[model samples]
Target: MASKIAEAELDSVEKVFAAQEAVPSWKDQLTFRSFVIGFLLTILITFIKVKVSLNTEIIPSLNVCAGLLGYFCLKVWTQCSSQLPFTRQENSVIQTCVVAGSGIAFSGN
Candidate 1:
């Protein structure tokens, strides 16, 4: 089973490298749509976190929330439109922006 997993990992890496060679490098993955969506989500989550903090002693997990939200959004987008210009790295950047914006929001509070 371990060997099988290792083989699968190697195959995946090979495929990634092959795909990388075929695809042109994207100069900018930070689209306005992704930025706006990420910013809005961060604001919404931060607001929820603040509200929860104020209403109860338990603190919400922002990291988990941000990760899950980003994953779900990316998954949905990928499923709905395979032709969309969004790439995996772009999704990553979006998530990072979301987390950073959330941190800024928290600092302000």
Candidate 2:
């Protein structure tokens, strides 16, 4: 049943969170690099959203687009620099910032 599936998902989420807390990464999640990347991505995504809105009136989903782009960009950056740590927390922060920035741009119109 759907209820059983939902309960299983909830249980899995709980276990994941518990495990995360048990093994702390202890890495800096809010680094300057994350902010810089997030700022650039926000500007880029905002511009694209504005242009798309003007042309097709169909705004793209910032969460999916920004998350994927941010992840890819960070991965590439890490591979190149080899100094920056690619932590999930940092990626989530950057993605959230970019998405929020794009949302603000959309609402301002």
Candidate 3:
């Protein structure tokens, strides 16, 4: 019985060793490259949202929600696949920009 188990283990190890595969994690996942790209995209969208809010005279409630939603998305990104370290400063910046932008947009509307 012991020999049988040992043989099975050896077979499994050999099979696994024979397999050629890329790294377990995605090559671009959570790299500084991806983080920077996401950050820039967020900035641009925030800018557009504020512009629209101003043009349409949106309400404060919607502005607040929009900002919160942006942070929520960031949270998801960080939790699921982000290799980037989460920081208080980063979160604070995101929250501030999002809230301020949303406010400006909703107020305009």
Q: For every model shown, what is its TM-score relative to the native structure?
A: 0.71, 0.72, 0.35
Cα deviation of 53, candidate 3, in Å: 13
Summed over model 3, clashes come to: 7
Q: For model 1, what is the alpha-carbon lDDT of residue 61?
A: 68
Highest-scoring model, lDDT:
2
Score candidate 2 by TM-score against the native: 0.72
Cα lDDT, all candidates: 0.74, 0.84, 0.55
Error of 1 at 89 (Å): 1.3
**Residues forming the 10-long window of minimal summed lDDT in candidate 3:** 22-31
- Looking at candidate 2, what is the lDDT of residue 38? 93
Q: Which ten residues in a row have the lowest lDDT in candidate 1?
A: 19-28
**Candidate 2's residue-wise lDDT over 2-107, tens digit each?**
9999999999988877755543454567777788889999999999989988999898786888888888988889989978567787788899899998899778
